[model samples]
Target: MMIKAIQLLVAVFGVLNLNGIECRKSRILNSFEYTAINCRVHSASIVDFGGVGDGKTDNTKAFQKAVNHLRQYASDGGAQLFVPAGKWLTGSFNLTSHFTLYLQRDALLLASQDVKTWPVVSPLPSYGHGRDAAGGRYISLIFGTNLTDVVITGANGTIDGQGVLWWQQFHKKKLKYTRPYLIEIMHSDKIQISNLTFVNSPSWNVHPVYSSNIIIQGITILAPVTSPNTDGINPDSCTNTRIEDTYIVSGDDCIAVKSGWDEYGIRYGMPTKHLIIRKLTCTSPYSAAIALGSEMSGGIQDVRAQDITAIHTESGVRIKTAIGRGGYVKNVYVKGMNLHTMKWVFWITGNYGSHADTHYDPKALPEIEGINFRDVVAENVTMAGRMQGISGDTFTGICISNVTIGMAKKGKKYPWGCEDVKGISSGVVPRPCNLLVDQGEGIVGMCDIPADSSAIDAMELKKCSYIG
Candidate 1:
């Protein structure tokens, strides 16, 4: 029964290497059943498709074959591909619709360092040029496009990028293409990426762009404190996404909400809205726990974050934008943030100054308003707030209430830095700027944690299992 598999791939796809999943990459005869969003009419192990997880051999073909073969069951009840315990080494693999990629608890999928394993793809329409280079960029280790009802979940399985090589190339200006992320899903819907440990990603770790109905939960992302551009969980141009119960330690922002960049973003014209973030813990010495744009020109709105915890981060929540970026960031609500050792508790600025190219219109201006924060506490803070807006166009409709921040021993003399922005503050420490002092406690009513329901709340996990 284990012999005859898929129609076309069964013949040429070749050998089963359960051996690689044991003895550090050797196959072992192991089988198990697990639960997920959908049960599979058919399932197979990577070993059945020449998988050598010995930590040395390249299992790229094996992974590709397994996914491609099982994809045929999509029209029936869907399919699942199980990856057992071992050190699996591979490069890039694409997922199909109605599929699940499950890794065992001890399984470690190591990314290949060989450039040939990675295929360079064209830049995103929202960003005309590559992020780090002038042209194309490497595809992610696990990529999927135009897919639906996909799940990339495991029982604390690990996906290690081994990104030192990529990082060095980026720092030395030796690469012609931008780096690849660990997992990227584009133009898809009903995606769930959870219960995974992602480390040392080449770039952003779980990027969902132009997608919707995504649930990213129970994730642990870790990278070196100095690794460049290793952002965790960047949701770009997506809607109705919920990111919860995630822990991250990184060099960049733990969670970055973006839409697009510059004129390309303006042209793409997709705003990320109706996002719900909850129970997130982050530690990043050089960046914010949560950031919205330095690249949001497509617009961003209807964001909600609550029960956030940050330790030794640059800021608790940061909004970054620049000129020539004609977007809007509005209807943002944040509450219940417990922060420690932060450069600033809240930060919003429009002088980020990174443009896609010189041709971006200088007359373009972003609309930033309706930002609210309440029920936040912080200790060991260098400063409380840094709110800067465009010189001529001041940011308005801001409110803050029920917040307390204790400054660091040798922190900045002035706890608040404000310019070209108007807001109302109540129950804030260190006495905010005169422009924000006019409001009373009524600001709390406006900025409190909203009781509203969103589309993402309707997404529910089901009892789905695969057998082997």
Candidate 2:
């Protein structure tokens, strides 16, 4: 009887085990049934389609073969094109949706230096703001279009733009080489770029324009200090961006948030919105740790920057706009920034010299509204200038709060008083009320009163730490 009972128990357990195995297999099959296939390549041993992997690399056909293979075998959907560990020298590569470029540890995708070798695609005319030192039209290096769910990820790797040749040209002229950016994502959505190093870009290192839900994190960009227009990251007319834990030591603005230019702005009709820049460090920068304008004619809104740490940067925080550039900057907040040295620790300058001798008339330009700065601790500043709440045709609804700064005096004595407040045309008057200085010895010097009584609400200074 005991033997019979044991046999029955074994049969029951066997049935349960069979059911579990069947369930597991069904799940695996379901996962495989609904997933996109991937195209994988080991970069180290890849000989171009010409079958020449002699290490003296001509990556043109090799990379084309990989891309073509992915295109052909891309399943019913798209595939992830994989690049394994090795150095791959290639020309310009285009990207598409349902595709990913994954680099493994110790991978190097080096850009070919020969300009003619790069295939040309007539992109929209760039947002032409100022001439670069390179003296040519701006071009982007890695250009993509209308792609979705694209990602560039790896453990250890680099994307070298070979911009030293381009930087040399920048020294001669300024507005040259309307060529390539290190990485350009255009008219794409859901793009993610992380965990890589971008070195020496011809133009802005990572340029993402006309995109949505973009993310860039855990990356390092190293560009020459004199490399003109080598902006670390320029997110133009993008939305829902989260850039975090990225290190940028560039010659120009570390992260410039801009829309298109005058006509370009209208055509794009897309503002850079819902941006969160956190845990970012700027070692060397020409402008603010995070800046706006110079091309903000398209308008920007719903942006927040926090937990920023900067060293040896020029401007701690800056927002600039010229006269002719008509746009609105609103719903912005900045906090938890630690800046060491800056020319203007906190600068909000309008009248951006759009036209020479046109003069800075605040009454004529569009208003910059809803700007807030709080919980910022800054030190080693030579000049702490505040150009806030200057009324032009469009200046209203701006505020600065909870700023603690340590001023570093330069050879030129710091200005004792504030700049003119009379809408630019009223000459220059020091207005008080909206301008608030919590900790600093700076004083608001001589000023003229505006004919409009409401203009007095434009400036304020409170909780002075420095007795200037």
Q: Pick the candidate with the highest lDDT.
A: 1
Give candidate 1 regions above 4 Å deviation.
Answer: 1-35, 442-444
Per-residue lDDT of 112 in model 1: 95
Per residue, candidate 2 scores C-alpha lDDT tens digits across 115-154 of 7676544434434333342233444545578877666665
Model 2 residue 213 distance off true place after TM-score fit, in angstroms: 0.7
Q: In TM-score terms, which candidate is top? A: 1
Model 2 bad stretches (over 4 Å): 1-56, 72-77, 123-139, 174-177, 353-364, 388-391, 409-434, 437-468
- The CA lDDT of each predicted structure is 0.87, 0.60
Q: What digit string (tens of lDDT, one per residue) describes model 1 on residues 274-351? A: 999999999999999999998899999999999999999999999999889989999999989999999989899889
Score candidate 1 by lDDT: 0.87
Q: Among all windows of ten consecutive residues in candidate 1, which has the lowest summed lDDT? A: 19-28
